[model samples]
Target: MSEITNFKGEAVTAKPENAADLEVEALIRSVGDRVRKARDLKGMPRRVVSELSGVSPRYLAQLEAGEGNISIGLLLRVAIALDLRIEWLVGGEDPWSSDVLRVADLFRSAPAGTREKVLELLSPEPPEAMRARRICLIGLRGAGKSTLGAMAGAKMGVPFVELNREIEDHSGMPVNEVMALYGQEGYRRLESQAVERVIAMHDTMILAVAGGIVADPDTYNLLLSRFHTIWVKASPDEHMSRVRAQGDTRPMAGNPEAMEQLKVILRSREALYERAHAQLDTSGRAPEESLERLLALIEDKGFLT
Candidate 1:
């Protein structure tokens, strides 16, 4: 728990002198933080939430600010009004994960089937089906996009472009340098610009995209509209093994929970990844075999002249 100022300006918690009490206080504050996030994400203002929850705006503010010792009944009412699970407020599950955020806003207002139909209607159809001139590959980092994209480009008589390399070239530095100089947000800003440039410059090419491009809905949707998207999927173990085989040990060097974090990210992103025109599972297969699968998917989708 955070300490509040006393009369003499000294900081103190309310009777939290024991370890268990401190833990309880911390949990209360954490729950408050989560409540605030859910409420904000649901587009519920304090006054509206208070009216719906029958808890005064002042109390709601205090609770959201982590200062109110709110009752369980009141908290439950708040949760219901916000359309959020109590377990999320209590931090059992991450409500802000991509998995939750992707659906939470929609699910709060509509059913799952309705949401799917809405998305299908909103998404634009590619002109060439899977034989689009702007062919793009998407997947986890260690997927065989680069290998297969190059080979596919060779067979199809078109150039292959790596979006990351394009990003680096556009930024006038390496991608790592861009991240270091401008941070992830800046890097992502540049990434969107680079995607546009790539689309404009290449009339017919195979594009290899960043693994986490799904995290950016705008760029990913742009790719979907303009390109024949193929998701090259591999098992979690294979993803880890492939990255490791490339001599990059940073994922596990200082973090023991790397694999679990990867699993969480994959779980959060799998649905978004499935939005691609086709999926190729590359587990236990050579790059050449994976390329064959990718070619088959493209051919089956009605490649044109």
Candidate 2:
């Protein structure tokens, strides 16, 4: 069914075996071209990809040259290192230009609020029904989220959850140990999972989340969509004092400019925090006063209704 040039420079009808071999070779070449293009587009050097994937640079070169018959395990490593789906590397469609992939990339990078708006537009459920009386307290560490959340949940006769505590429970270790073992990115992944678990478990509850959650767009967006968020803020001085009062002096230990750093973090996150549905400033207030005010605010806003 196909013609081939013989060694004697004569055109001959290719046998079925030869045609199958040619098809295999063509597939190999196509895979190599895709790998090379993806590497170039990402600006990742062969050696860097090797380091990330634990595949040797020489093997990578051979694979990209269409000469290496790569094993599935090794290809999987490369795909993971490139932050790509394995199927994308071998699929017939051009992943970069595919409508589905392009839309997925755009949605991933969009802000949490924008993504929520898009989801709301697409979903049949109204925002109020999806949220379903879920209240989330978000602010910097020591802004009294956990303390106030527990008190408020008890007073309001609803369940209270601390996101980090849920993470710790799920991991079977302390939060500090989780941070030490997983680093920032790993911790954020666990944090996102914990948020999802809480959402799945409770439609009517109070939640206290980590301060840095806003730094993660996807997870924070998911939180905003599922919970009625309140920014529970206090002065930087109070933040430090409250943490110290809890016997955690790590924030100020041997750090002269700790307050300045806290202020900087707060300023950086101000815009993100402002996206919350409501705000409760606990600065210069007693626990009882803050609790009463939080209750009043929730009632006034009809958050549970």
Candidate 3:
């Protein structure tokens, strides 16, 4: 370059031969950034990670600063300590990509038959062990959970259960009374119990769940693991319309902000709702059309046990 005045100019002047060195430096910096970013996000102190990873704190600081040379064993130890994937520690910026790499790592370490099994589990197709033999309908109120759930079960020739009803039967109290007496936390405790009981009672069935079930972490976790959850997704307006069509004006009483309130609740829970194994959008579709879609999805996916 014409008289290097900055780092960029100096690199341009010298890097034709040193491109490999530059690439290595960039990789180091990227790894360092990822390590520190993940550590900071977890609110983990450097000393804590160092202790857990069995690496010295000084080395951890150096590693996070792109100045330390690490071995594969140390990298594995660090990954286990941070509950992260080595691929994430080394190169990827995408979390999902790291998850895929972690699966690859698992597959590589597994025994011969176990390798195939691991690959099956990692595939997008549902795994045998965790497959939803018992289907569950999950969504906000007015998303057709009950109607569609019953129809799907009927079509599939299996029993259908409403989890809220199960909760009442188990507790010997109305759901509203349970909520009023004990609050949301109390209701959720009962919900988890009901889910467990249902799983025990019937191995193959369809279950319609309460709209707010996803709000409880424990119960939601149960739903995720035990049931092949299908989210009955609909726009907030569509939800309110369905509710109103069912002649329920309670949600729309004198409050002018009823729709906004519904929207807020839907927005808050959308991410949680999305965790379901599959989603069926009922925004513009009629009940019959939506039921057909849901049934087709269940049939295509073979979620039936």
Among these predictions, the greatest TM-score belongs to 2
- Cα lDDT for residue 98, candidate 1: 92
For residues 22-76, what per-residue lDDT tens digits would candidate 2 score against the true structure? 7766776677788888898889999988986777887777678866666666786
* Candidate 3: tens digits of C-alpha lDDT, residues 5-96: 12221212223247776676666666767778778867899989887667788777766886655566676667756666676677645554
- Answer with 2 or 3, whichever has the higher TM-score: 2
**Superposing every Cα of model 2 onto the true structure, what RMSD results?**
12.6
Relative to the true structure, how large is the alpha-carbon lDDT of every model? 0.78, 0.85, 0.76
- lDDT: which candidate is best? 2
Tens digits of lDDT, candidate 1, 1-305: 36443333344578777999888778878888998887877688898988767778977777777777777667766876676555678866777999778776665457545644565676575356423577889999888888888998888788999999987654568999988999988888778777766665666788999889888766777687778888888988888888999999988889999999889989999999999988889999998887788778877874423
- Output candidate 3 Cα RMSD: 19.8
Clashing pairs in 1: none
TM-score per candidate, chains pooled: 0.57, 0.64, 0.58
2 versus 3: better lDDT goes to: 2
The clash numbers for all candidates, in the given order, read 0, 0, 0
On lDDT, the stronger of 1 and 3 is 1
